[model samples]
Target: MLELRPGCECCDRDLPPDSADARICTFECTFCVDCVDNVLRGVCPNCGGNFAPRPIRPASKLTNNPPSQKRTFNPDCFPASR
Candidate 1:
């Protein structure tokens, strides 16, 4: 099961369970679209893998399979200027 992490690991942006902005690597290292497109340049800082849009869990299923409350913030993952 996907952790459906609650926020972008790079920018700490809020990415709710259903947010289309969420992108994740094969390892499920989550980030926002902005960070993936601009800052990280389609690369995952943690795993050095390409990112794909995270699948949104259905609202009905969310009740049974809750999204993770953990927020992984790695401000140093990329340069701020990028």
Candidate 2:
């Protein structure tokens, strides 16, 4: 199951499970559309992998399969150590 993350890892902006703005890498490193396009250049800063729009969990299934509350924010500035 996909871990529907609650926010963008880069900007820490809220990205609820149904948000259309969420983007993620193969490693599930989440970011907002703004960060993914402008800041990240459509690649994940953490994994150096391409990003794609995150899948939205359906509202009916959300009760049983809730989105993750465990927010994974980016604590470091950009140009993180390679």
Candidate 3:
């Protein structure tokens, strides 16, 4: 199952379970659309793989399969100016 991460790894932006802004690499490295387009240019910093829009879990299923509360912040993954 996808972790459905709670935030962007690069910018630390909030990405709720159903956010359309979430993007993830093959390795499940999550980031926001802003960071994926602007900072990463579709490339994942943690893995040299391309990113894809993260699938949103259905609201009904979220109760049993909760989204991950753990956040992964990696400012060094992108430029400091971001």
For model 1, the stretches where C-alpha displacement exceeds 4 angstroms are 80-82
Top-scoring candidate (lDDT): 1
- Per-residue lDDT over 13-60 for candidate 3, one digit per residue giving the tens place of the 0 to 100 score: 999999999999988999999999999888888878999999999999
Question: lDDT tens digits, residues 5-34, model 2?
Answer: 899887799999989999988988899998
Q: How does model 3 fare in lDDT?
A: 0.92
Ranking by lDDT: 1, 3, 2
The candidate scoring highest on TM-score is 1
Per-prediction tally of clashes: 0, 0, 0
* Cα lDDT tens digits for candidate 1, 26-80: 9999999999998999999998999999998999999899999988999898875
Task: Give the least accurate 10-residue stretch of model 2, judged by summed lDDT.
Answer: 73-82
RMSD in Å for all candidates:
1.2, 2.7, 1.4
Give per-residue lDDT, candidate 3, residue 5: 89
Q: What is residue 44's positional error in candidate 1, in angstroms?
A: 0.5
Candidates 2 and 3 compared: the better one by lDDT is 3
